[model samples]
Target: MLLRLLLLICAPLCEPTVVFLRASPSQPIEGNSMTLTCKIQHAPLKSDAQFCFFKDGQTLGQGWNSFPEFQIATMWKENSGSYWCGAKTASSKAIWSQSIQIDVQRVPVSNVSLEIQPPGGHVMEGEKLILVCLVAGGTGDITFFWYKGALGLNLETKTRRSLTAKFEIPTVTESDAEQYYCAADNGYGPSLSGLVRITVRIPVSRPVLTLRAPRAQAVVGDVVELHCEAQRGSPPILYKFYHEDVTLGSSSASSGGGVSFNLSLTAEHSGNYSCEANNGLGAQRSEVVPLNITVPTEDRKELLTSGVIEGLLGILCPTTIALLFCCWLKRKIGRRSARDPPRSAPSPVPQQPTYLNSPDPVQQQPIYQNVNVVSGDEVYSLVYQMQQELQSAVVEPPRTRNEDKDPSAIYSWLKKANDTDLDYEDAM
Candidate 1:
């Protein structure tokens, strides 16, 4: 009866207790170390206890004095299986712990970058950029998928056990260039690598160069800037300058592909100048421009100086000759005017005739005389002869009177007859 009572108390005290398993970083990177922890429900009264861990029905480690811990070394593909742990006392049979399934996961990703053909060192539109996904320590079927913004891109697989996967997007456009991610999976949940930022860098179009000058006649040995410009093109272009069929210098344009050159020129550079612009696609040349310079003439200055001294003498000689000729002509004309008279004048008067003549001989007769008068033959004959004698004379006859008794009467009568005859003749 005492032995039966003692056996019943020992049986109740010898029962086994369980410990729970704990892991750090519940998720771990491949090929790196990880720790698993175990804890006992009750501390053993005696320090003599046995602990053992098993995986897939095989022992992992065994110890006579056991603690609540287990560690796996150099974890590889073979270590990926189910695991469990149990504890036992030295005086009792071992008890089992709950089963725990551990799975060896794939490594996290590294080193993802975009590769391009005719690489611009960046991905851009109208250029084909290859996407490569690589893992350091993994071997399985890989699917190359591309993610853009929020969508996934599926690519056909070429190999099953390849650690690297490649995706080819031919003739990439603007939409293809985006933030991209690639994932590798062998029946494991998707582990996305980092991102590849794609920037579509469009190449510059054909550039055009134009040149200008502030003035048409750009003098030699003078400061001048020749402007070079592009009409339609992308920026960041390089420009080269030329002068007089010879190259001078080079420059770059960042924004508008416009550049200028400041040249302190010499006489040898006074000719055509041109410029060329390029941006990898092609090059353009500006039109040829010409420059000229002017200088003072030495001969012209000497000629002007000599002309000043002789100018007054040359002017006065001709003026003096002309004045002398004009004075002589005026004096000759005055003398001719004084010597000539006008034709309009009156004529002289003629002499008158006068009459006073005594050229012919003449005779005078008596004024009166007395005479007798008878009518008988003797008296008649005497009277007839006296009358005949009186008729013969050319002069006027004398007057006569009675002879004897009346002499005084005869004078008176004769004077009266004379007076009557004078009166009768003057009347006729």
Candidate 2:
């Protein structure tokens, strides 16, 4: 019929193209091995074309022979999908190509987890810190990396097979603490994840109470000590001590810096002395140190009551000034023996003259009338007699004067009255 109408007029003037080449490893991994050729552009190198292979629309292989490649050794997971290739020519009809989509990955029994959003991984340097990686039982396109201790951070890809994969750190320092994990690859090998340690909290700082006294004069049984510190805290701190507000001792530095507290001094431990450091992120204090307490002159009842009050004022002040000067010299010798006085007693020796004229008295006394007789001689005689008689006896002595005498007998009676008045005037 004119060679069948010249092969349908040369198949509408040579138009036959069924490409589908490229796929050596376009994306294949599950047990690996791939290849998919199938050309046939302008057909007719001897035509009679026969190459086949289609997928999404079924029909894997029905004809092949010249330049029709299509392998897939071992690759599974249903050998993925979307493939194309066709070219029939024994007289034309059927031509398809262009449709390659063979994915197949699946080497991922992964299971990489590492989530920490606001869950106690304790963040505070500046805040905000999330990790998350997940990706369990993966299969096709899946990347997700993110590490931290061994470095290597951020990397996510999950084309359409996701399960989770995040990574943020908007702040959070102190070298970001460290130790975190997550990984998952999908093209096989690489599934890490199981390490999570990140802590960065820091707060407690105002403490600094230092006393340490072995002797700067904190006496009364001394022992003192007390050091407490907190330069830049972040540990198990907790150091407390205070004194005018009571609560005296407590110490616990647990790996950080300072802590002491001994104290034994008494006298009420004087006064104001503070310190507190806590570490749960707050609680500071410290700054009020006074502490006085002193009373040691080698005390022993205060040195025996100051030596018995200075030995009773040094023995009653000189025995009360020598007993007031012996009572003022016994009242000045009894006021000088009552001012002066008394002596008296001594007299009598005039008898001789009396007798000289008395004897005549007796005889002449008889002449009474006017006897004018001239008797000069007789008168003399009579006078004598009368004098004698008159001179009579005189005797008066003993009127008490013997105060136990003997002051040389009153100077020997004034030397015997001046020798008897000069011998009684030479015996008259």
Highest TM-score among the candidates is held by which one?
Answer: 2
lDDT per residue for candidate 2 within 270-337, as digits (tens), equals 88899899988789998999988876666747657877978997998898777666555544443342
Report, for every candidate in turn, its global Cα lDDT versus the true structure: 0.55, 0.66
1-428, model 1: which lDDT tens digit per residue?
A: 89999888776567646565566535444455556665566545446666677778887666434565677644544567777666677676776677766666665333433344445436545666777766554533444455655465544444435567777777776556567667665555555666667666445443333444456665544678777777654457788888865878888887755788888865456667788878665777877766765322553465466676578669887988887777666556544543443232112121122223632322221122222212111110001001112133477545442211122211111113333342111100
| CA lDDT, candidate 1, residue 152 | 57
Off by over 4 Å in 1: 1-127, 137-143, 147-162, 172-181, 184-190, 194-206, 215-223, 229-237, 253-256, 264-271, 278-284, 287-428
Off by over 4 Å in 2: 1-27, 30-36, 40-43, 46-79, 87-93, 96-105, 109-125, 128-139, 143-164, 169-192, 205-219, 222-233, 236-252, 255-260, 266-285, 289-428
